[model samples]
Target chain A: MRAFVLATAAAAIALGAATTPAQAGATLDAVKARGEVVCGVNTSLYGFSYPDDKGVWRGLDVDTCRAVAAALFGNAQKARFVPLSAQARFTALQSGEIDMLPRNTTWTLTRDTANGLNFAPTTYYDGQGFLVAKKLGVKSAKELSGATVCVQTGTTTELNLADYFRANKLDLKPVTIEKYEEVTAAYLAGRCDALTSDISQLASIRANDTPNPADHVILPEVISKEPLAPAVRHGDDQWYDIVVWSIFATMQGEEFGLTSANVDQALNSSDPNIKRFLGVTPGLGAALGVDEKWAYNIIKQVGNYGEIFDRNVGKDSKLQMARGLNAEWTKGGLMYSPPFR
Target chain B: MPTVRWYNNRRVRGVLYQIIVLGGVVALAAYLVDNTLHNLERRSIATGFDFLGREAGFGISETLIDYSPADTYFHALLVGLFNTLKVSIIGIVLATVLGTIAGIARLSRNWLVAQFATFYVETLRNIPVLLQLFFWYALITEALPVPREALNPLPGVFLSARGMRFPEPVWGATHVAMLVALIVGIVAAVILARWARRRQERTGQIFPTGASATALILGLPAIAYIAGGAPTALDMPELRGFNFTGGVVVTPEFAALLIGLVLYTGTFIAEIVRGGILAVSHGQTEAGLALGLSRGLVTRLIVLPQALRVIIPPLTSQYLNLTKNSSLAVAIGFPDLVSVANTAINQTGQAVEGVAIIMAVYLTISLSISAFMNWYNQRIALKGGR
Candidate 1:
């Protein structure tokens, strides 16, 4: 009798599991139906994605999500952020809990293929670097041999740290904590001699998390190339293109000298490139299966790439980080967009 | 063929129900497994345990075994297993001792001792283990001084946020010989104990088995050490570029985790121990005292022997709980089995296999502990009684 009851329960669970629709390339339709784009972001990264005092999400990554929302629904407020840790980010994307992941996730071959994720475009070009207390009198990464470094687990930083130390023939002990706050806390509490992370994150942590920002110095050596990009699950080409073009719109806006303030005035501009890019010519929006005013909505709502950077982690923010490798191609950097035509 | 309908027959009904249930369970399991595999394949996640043989290019903070970034994932996981065992075994032993002491004290005639045990139980058992872990981690890191100005509390022992560094004797042939001698001594001691017990059973004369066993074990190794010239070369840790260079360092992470697990599990074990002792009737203790036994002797000889039947089963669960709770070491950066497996999952993008490995490991450990405890309980159980 007990066996019968147990089997019935098991069959019920199987029925429920079978009812969950298998995911395919319907993310765009799902987003449209749901009226919101759920983007996974960093839990508490200062400039990449974090909540402000009013609990409003704001960062470069957050703006990317907003840009996607504006491109889709023509309303930036239609985007929502789900904060994720380094370990949970990819699983969230894979499980379809989040529509897109802009959580400072690195674009690697394993993630792009093995994890069943597709990278859109490089949003933030980062590299592994070290930050140490100034009192340590360390000027270069080479000086950090035998140093115990605090790092967040489940990131490229951990792998890069191991590779760098091995290649350099240095003895390094890493305190791999799961959370950003705990990792930094360990470093600040003298449990580690230094902290290893991307230079952008190091800058953010120094500017915001530390008691004395001046006490920490970022090392000069860049150990590994960390091309951080927004990701979407594979098998969704339409949704993938939407996210790609949304970010490219921001960069193209910057290329064409458009900002959130001046984008409205550009509606009347005669520049063919600007008009074509902004969907004044109707083919671009129709191609991505969005409204004709999609690019315009993004530029107006989330601003151009330069404006986004400056407002969040650049000179306008407390981080005061330089747009060293994120500048426009015309200015000798890597930010480039294909021709609108 | 029967007078009554087949459905009305109890045997027929039972067989039919069991078959239906079995079919349903099998079908459910097959569907779930098939669905999961299909999803995994569709998502491009590489399945199987192939990744275990791949290189693990990450470092663990405190490893019990030798590990480098160049090691295979299998080797790294072995290190992780060792680390888990290291903490769990030590935690179990220390928790048992602490619990037994506290349990006895809780029933003490002295007011202060009993109140103190009560205070320890209440404070530790009420708060969450994770919170206690965080508290201990923070306290260790925040309160300890930096390595350069490490507190020298004892000669050749330094306490700092980096770790507690102490000198260790350098390993040599003499140490090897001593280890062999110690093992031999233990075997000899056990044989002697059996012989003494048998002699006491046959003859009415008592034997000092405890003193004799202690002498045999320590004296054998001592003679071996002296004969081998007693080379006492110590490797003392020295302040190096960033940390201490040599000797053993008990990291703040490991220490905090151990302290938290022991204290948290100790409280429950203490309660279990107290309950077990209390469950033994007062009559047994009174009977022993009336027969001219001391209070300590009465509790040990009469009450505890019976209490074993009650204590051993619950104590098994406490052991399992401590082992499982050691997985919380990940939260504090102790790099136990779960922590290493998580890192592997993230690196390999093989979440399914990684999780499976963790489950298998913990299951094996818990089952082994349960089996041992059961055997011990059986040995102490009353013969020819329900």
Candidate 2:
């Protein structure tokens, strides 16, 4: 009996040691060899990661995932979309379940450091806000003392609510529901006085509201800064830089007026910065351990940041959210690319 | 010599089989643990339970105990466990009463009553619990008007998108005395029931035990109320500006979760009750009737005893199932143990410890329920028969 137990223990220990670190830091290398990127995305947030009628996933976040795939494989469709929830997203990334997460996740200090994950450039600058019925006659969140607020569980919104209420010295009661759908339901049912979430989410919710959406008003309270960015598991600086540069490449392309529709026309341009950005000139991609044509592939196959955003969330989409803080640096928004030179 | 050899061989084989099974289980467990550790390490992720002591920088929506973002993961877990228990206990109590009424209605001679009971069971049972939770939380609740435009159900009650707000009584000495009387009345009813049973056995006579017990319970509380200062005023909910000024409010999350759980679990309980009642033989009722017993007597004295034997076991399982299903509150963000742990895990990156704590709590709750049911089943079980 003792010998049998010993033998089993030995076998288990051996197997554990063999497979643990075998695939750890080699995820980026493996992706390059396979010529495809696996990007995790939100399963069901409108304008972020929802699917169209034809079952093709398209959204602002999904476009970022596609851009990364285009940069790596020269074909945007080569990326596999892995859907994840707020609870399952981090673990999936750490376990190598997906290569990158473009799931509108906030870049918190804990997630960036303690969680062994690194976030790329901020894609969207957002803040927490509340949506309430206009019939309540409340113009600002400060007037919502002792009112019940519905918030989704397991998100930054929960803490942000606490901070906002505490800072305002308001004694607000929070009615926590679990899913994004539940928060919407409770708010719509008049079971909660207000629904709190990101300002962008408020826009989407208001757009999808039944009856006349004009009956509801989003309060002017942008509490807690939410800088959402794509994240990769830590330990691979090469993978980190690849995703960061991919995002910057899109912004840089937009700055140079190179759209997916105009990329082919502008390919023979004489401007040094445009040529360097399109990889007509070498060295930039090689510096990031990728080919020189990486930026050109991203713009040609996936379009630039503005095109992706306008298609998914701006005036053309169901969520007609205007570009506020998400606009380019020169255009008075926070989005700025590091010098492409 | 052959008989002795057979005995020795049987013992040896039993020992060898036990060893092999034990060894296999240990080996499998060890392999999994090792693989998990290796994977975590290679990914540069720390694998340990030390994260439980770390601060959880997230707040929960509805918590029974005091919790803040500054609290440790351990405290957050406690709050989650408390919420789970709170919802389950209320759900169990409400489901039992609702199920009992519906079950009896299904057996009623009235066609409308029976059909209504049947419709309820079929409709609720067919739909998934998570979907039902969403329906209650979102669609039903969100349709209500804002607080300023809330429809007043009564002078002291307001119904709005925020939730139902009603009056809360400010308790005094008289209230405490009345509460004590209610407790005493329940004790007296139990004693009277035992006395009535003894009297029935001693003489060939019966008393209206049910009526007598009900009167004892209600009458005593009434007497106490009068003696303990009868005019108790209600502190009604008053609408001020845009919201209610003073009232005890039940948050929408609690209301939605409670309603969803009870509605979903009550259907199963109703079916269980129906099955239990049907399992009792019709002959038992006929025999009671033949003995000059009334219809109510036939059911209460003859059929119910047998039906209870079949009912208790399944009913216990349903209660346990409802308790476990309460964890699904995560779907609608109910701040239950599972949801709280999920937040803690994400904020702290303590997946290993968070999941372990959640599993342990649920397993403990399951075992406790099973143990209680086993004890109850033994007490009611028929003795010494095949």
lDDT tens readout by residue for model 1, A1-341: 55568777777787777667477788898999999999999998888899999999999999999999999999999999999989988889988899999999889999998888999889889998999999999999988888999999999899999999999998889999998889999999999999999999999999999999999999999999999899999888999999999999999999999999999999999998888888887798998899989999999989999999999999899888889899999998899998777
How high is the lDDT of residue B250 in model 1?
A: 94
Model 1 chain A scores worst on lDDT over the 10 consecutive residues at A1-10
Question: What does candidate 2's lDDT look like per residue over B262-362, in tens digits?
Answer: 99889988988899899998888888899999998898877877888898888988899899989888876677899888877776776877788889999
Top candidate by DockQ: 1
The chain A TM-scores for the candidates, taken one by one, are 0.94, 0.93
Scored by TM-score, the top model is 1
Q: Which residue pairs collide, candidate 1?
A: none
Candidate 2 regions exceeding 4 Å error are A1-22, A29-35, A208-214, A269-276, A313-327, A330-333, A339-341, B2-8, B44-63, B66-73, B195-209, B291-295
Worst 10 residues of 2 chain B by lDDT: B1-10
TM-score of each: 0.96, 0.89
Share of the reference A-B contacts seen in candidate 2: 0.53
lDDT of 1 by residue, B52-139 (tens): 9999999988777799999999999999999999999999999999999999899999999999999999999999999999999999
